[model samples]
Target: MKKPLDSEVFSSMLDASISYWRQQGKKGVWIKLPLELSNLVEAATKAGFRYHHAEPDYLMLVRWIPNNTPDVLPANASHRVSIGAFVMNSKREVLVVQEKYGRFSGIGLWKLPTGAVDEGEDICTAATREVKEETGIDTDFVEVLAFRQGHKSFFQKSDLFFICMLQPRSFDIQKQASEIEAAQWMPIDEYAAQPLVGGNELVNLITKVCLARFGGTYNGFSPQLTTSASGKQTFLYFNGHFP
Candidate 1:
């Protein structure tokens, strides 16, 4: 059910659903809960549902009716989330980096610094870390400029791509020895005309979108990780990250 009513209504609905699905003798049912419906989420869980995979905005909860079946999630639901930085310098040049090894290792396709988000990493923080790792350029993340998801590219595995706009603070391009071949601040037009950057439809559009959204302000949000003397890591989102 889409965002259900209040908890009482949802409880009645869940009761009816359980009665009906039990009569049908089917395998299972899935409750897709938007992140906003934490109350309903709790209600569902209290009704014997369990956690499943999650998307950027939605949470999936599942319950198996079959006595023998393990709760099987959608096979394609496992998507890896990643971040890319579109860093622009005061000179109007964007930070581009060449990977030491990848699909575009030697093809000379300079891309916006991109990397995988760690298990507990914050999105904007990941973007800034990726930029610093790939190009040795320190940046303050502005905001998420654009996102693209596709299964066409990677062995039918879905990928979530967050392209962010960042302000360049430090300029030296000390490329990471292991992963980066080289890094440079290239003129926007010059960067776009290149093969990989220009040829890929999603990449091209996100770059354009980032450039278009550059001047306009965006209130950036990132999770704050704090460590105490006891050696524990705590993750907290900006509560109201985006204004």
Candidate 2:
């Protein structure tokens, strides 16, 4: 009789085989190895599979499981009043506001004209109100594109992002003394080059989302984590950190 393969060796071989098969676009390959393959069994378990015993070898079985459906946002959700906006102009430049107060101060970075969604107001209504209050621009039609939440943060609040198309209106850009320092419309390239208050990961996610909508590029959104100087870690898009 042949000696059984070592568990460690079996695991390594299994991993390598899986990688090769994945690269080749092959699906659902199983391995029958020895019962002494403890490491292989553990790895298969971690990969959402179960192991069974066969006559001379252990049977490694894999099953495809669909991801659980995400929970639906409450119709009357009153978590927090955070908001983000995507304001585009006739010149193809997007309007991003600099946060004057809070943790993102003096960053010279760009962000959507957003603020808290007031109590007793719908997200769309709150978005319109925030834009008007922040940038002095009144937007009539508000459309929500995506919703985001952070894992954890300093502020301990949820951020709601809306993709809104503005109506034809004329107004002067003014900064609210209490909240914003400066406001401007910058081209996509210029905005992309500027540093982001939320960090590089956030900027990348926002860029991908915007490009997919307006620039015909469709890379999906990637979440980010930002750790502040004060040792407070906040999940970007899920919450805001205020200094």
* Runs off by more than 4 Å, candidate 1: 1-77, 152-156, 217-243
Off by over 4 Å in 2: 1-78, 154-168, 197-199, 216-243
TM-score for all models, in order of appearance: 0.60, 0.51
- Write candidate 1's Cα lDDT for 101-197 as tens digits: 8788988888888899988777877988998877788888776766778665555668898877788899888889998988899999899898777
What TM-score would candidate 1 get against the native? Answer: 0.60
| Candidate lDDT (C-alpha), each | 0.79, 0.59
Please estimate how well model 1 matches the true structure, expressed as its whole-model Cα lDDT.
0.79
The candidate maximizing TM-score is 1
Model 2, span 52-85: residue lDDT tens: 3344555545533333544232222224646677
Clash count, one per candidate: 0, 5
The local lDDT score (0 to 100) that residue 167 gets in candidate 2 is 42
